[model samples]
Target: MENISFNMVFTLSGLKESKVNRYIYFVFVLIVYLLIILFNVTVIVTIILERALHEPMYIFLCNLCFNGLYGTAGFYPKFLSDLVYGIHLISYNGCLLQIFVIYSYGVCEYSTLMIMAYDRFVAICKPLEYHMKMASKTIGRLILFSWSFAFLTVFGGIVLTSRLRLCGSHIDKSYCDNWSVVKLSCLPTTVNNVYGFFVILSAVVQGLFVVYSYMRLINACRKSKENKKKFMQTCVPHLLSLINFTLAILFDTMFSRYESRDFPQSLRNFLQLEFLIIPPLLNPIMYGLKLAKIRKVVFRHHRQIEDSLHTKKR
Candidate 1:
């Protein structure tokens, strides 16, 4: 692994070492990645094709699925290719690009959820102004803001990481991340630390706002049966997804940043992969199962396909 900024390379030291185990890991991950792509793309296409599903909530759900695909793309392809190699290495630019895509996907998840929370809050608590406030134009602008914030913040961190003169190349993880790369640097990382804290603080603030919005949503639901049904149908899935994504990433981050050698490597590897595996596959499943509109469209299409097959047999 070279260290001259332009030619620098990183060694990913976390892959399965045995030849047989590596093949097993590769097939398993390939299955998971295909399912992730299938489920997310299904939801995205469902939303796009069904005009009735073109509401703000569904649009936000589409964006979430898009982010899932975006985030997973960062690690899965390269990791799968590396599985066949005895030594897993990534170029410095490749590392930075992976960091930017993966982290930005996380930030975008938080941003999309926050926007959905606000949409629910307005719909339930401020019913009269829901349409006016969450107009088509507003939703577009909000999504634009969500993605822009993600790109800019992660880019800043990437820039900070790029300036560091790395003294090491080995990263004891399955993929590249800003923190892991930063740890390779010999010099102090004060600026990177402050910026990292800022990013976390911003995410924390977003989480708090989401909590407050849900609280208000709960209160509003108490007075109306309709609101309660909506809450159960839509808001519950949103909360679960938020919890699912947040906890997976948080657990990964917790162990990644401050984990111990006392833990088993197998367990560490599985936990490290939770965020990438669970949310992408589950978010689309959750929304497809929980959201009535999407479910109806899915079921109806299934029946139609079955009927078409039946006719062909006849």
Candidate 2:
């Protein structure tokens, strides 16, 4: 067998067909990335600066936005540079780092959402005990668990991938993914596959936990109009964000594992990038619009700014 290349750089083939429109694509993506940053940051700052919005639910929302920003930073900068320079190559270490940031972002997202679900479950199902159950210490621990669990889980996969002797350096997708890297290995990847499936199973279990929490919430809300109102006010935004993320992840997973070359290049690219593009953009928007307190705070801040500017102009 030929010696595996440790220093090989991977070529991202997703941009091959878009060379003609790379400039246009770059501008569009840049605008989207900027908007994502702006939207998420707006809410995050609002939560921090406004003490009223510093409850467990809002804290989790802030963390969610932070995770969105963290995840996108891993992809957008490198992607924009690739578009401008017409280079799609990433070094081996860079590839693994990207895989770690992006996938850990994803896992952290699910973990955060799961916590949000539990928060809602407590707030609605056990309103009297909600304070004790989701206190500052509890919320802090949950946040820590979310980040640590995601980092460790994805870290294990990255470590396994780093140990592999790679046979090829070309990645058909726009970004570095754990599965894609494992597929490039020259030898059997049984361990990686087994661990990968375990990760998937863990994520599925998280999803189910969120689902079960919501189910209990629905049952609890059925008895009281006030509970139903709270559910509509707070839980609806979480549900929308959850649905959006689920679909994006589902598309990327299906495409990465079972994609066909016969699909249109643009569609394929969209599938590959939907999670990065949609969730980060949509999560903040949904929270800002649907959550009453956030919406009111954001608009009030905008009005205050406008009034201050008008006074200066006058």
In candidate 1, which residue ranges exceed 4 Å CA deviation?
A: 1-3
TM-score versus the correct structure, for each prediction: 0.96, 0.97
TM-score computed on alpha carbons, candidate 2: 0.97
Relative to the true structure, how large is the alpha-carbon lDDT of every model?
A: 0.90, 0.91
Q: Positional deviation of 167 in candidate 2, in angstroms?
A: 0.8
Clashes of each: 0, 0
Instruction: Give the local distance difference test score of model 1.
Output: 0.90
lDDT of 1 by residue, 6-120 (tens): 5778888766668999999889999999999999999999999999999999999999999999999998999899987766898988888999999999899989999999999
Candidate 2 regions off by >4 Å? Answer: 1-4, 17-20
lDDT of 2 by residue, 1-314 (tens): 44445578899975764576999889999999999999999999999999999999999999999999999999999999999999899998899899999999999999999999999999998889999999899999999999999999999998888888887888889999878878888789999989989988998998999989999999999999999999999999899888888888988888888878898988989988999999899999988998999999999999999999999999
